[model samples]
Target: MDKFDKKILTALHENARISYAELARRVNLSAPAVADRVEKLEHAGVITGYHARINPAKIGYPIQGLIELTVKHQDYYIVMEQLGTMPEILECFSVTGTSGLLLKVAVHSMPDLQALIARLMQYGDTKTSIVIDVPVPLRMPEVVETE
Candidate 1:
């Protein structure tokens, strides 16, 4: 990747919907050149996918929380499969330390969260924490020139 590629990536990270002409202007490249570079980036898997950020509270899921679960060694994959079927689970990660998995969940109410936890406990012990605020929301990695 060259400087122009990095600039194109940085611009796209700021706004994925930017037109090729605008991107070309920002990167000092022709529209066709910018499009070709973006295509190459996509093919190389440097650009995975684009997404829209949503507010759970506005969408009727006001309660948000983190769940730390420590599952038995034999039930790890089974628990992961079950978690995939649960819509309330927004994200799940296989983590280290005492916890085997960490899950980000959103629900309509405390009762909903309670029910989800009760279901998860069937796998193993769980620690749940309600999220009051998110000071720094998810941000894409900023592309920078390498030495």
Candidate 2:
């Protein structure tokens, strides 16, 4: 990838829905050139997927939390697969240390959280911490040095 490719990626990070013509204009490239670059990026897996940000409060799930789980043995993949199917579990990770998995969850209320935790009991021991505020939510990927 060259400087032009980097510029194109930066622009796409800001707005993935930008038209090919508009992207070409901003990047100072012809539409076909821009299209070719973007296609290459997509094929190479540099551009994985596109998504829209949604407000949890607007969706009736106002509460957000992180859950730390300690499972018996090393059955993280099985437990993670189950968590993935649950609507309340927004994100899940297989982590290092005593806590085998960490999960980001969103729910309607404390009662909902409690119910979710109860269900998770079948899998393993769990602890939860409610999020007070997200000072910095997830951001778009920025340019990074590659060896």
Candidate 3:
């Protein structure tokens, strides 16, 4: 939106729990104005949801990976359904190229990972890659002002 809105968003992205007064100060607006902007932003779907970043390893999910699936046919909805029911699948994406679906998975042990892969293989061929380390952890994208 405007520069003030962008500033508010940048401040909130850094800390969602920031007080309205503090946000107002950062954006050079009154607290009420800042609150109104935040409300509008939420209503407009610019701010969808807030979340806490957790350590998967510390939470007993030592294994994290991406599974690239190349399905047998076009009707892959069944596979998508099954993937939705699986707690191990954190995120799924439909990308172009060879892979029909890409899944982000988290599991506790090697046995669990093997079982997940076996279940997935029933749909079609899959390529699994365990995450060794993340150089850039997930972060909020910048809210640049646009025309």
- For model 2, state the Cα shift of residue 28 in Å: 1.6
Error of 3 at 128 (Å): 0.8
RMSD of 2: 1.9
Number of clashing pairs, model 2?
A: 0
Winner by lDDT between candidate 3 and candidate 1? 1
Put the candidates in TM-score order, highest first. 3, 1, 2
- Model 3, residue 141: C-alpha shift (Å): 3.0
| Candidates ranked by lDDT | 1, 3, 2
lDDT of 3 by residue, 1-147 (tens): 989888987888888889999999888999999999999999999999877777888999999999998886665988888889999999999989898899999999999999999999988889999899899977667767775
* Candidate 1 vs. true structure, TM-score: 0.91
lDDT of 1 by residue, 1-147 (tens): 889989988888888999999999999999999999999999999999876778999999999999999999999999899999999999999998999899999999999999999999999999999999999877667666664
Clashing pairs in 2: none
CA lDDT, candidate 1, residue 49: 85
Which one wins by lDDT: 1 or 2?
A: 1
Q: In terms of TM-score, which candidate is stronger, 1 or 2?
A: 1
In model 3, where is the ten-residue run with the lowest total lDDT? 138-147
Q: How many backbone overlaps does candidate 1 show?
A: 0
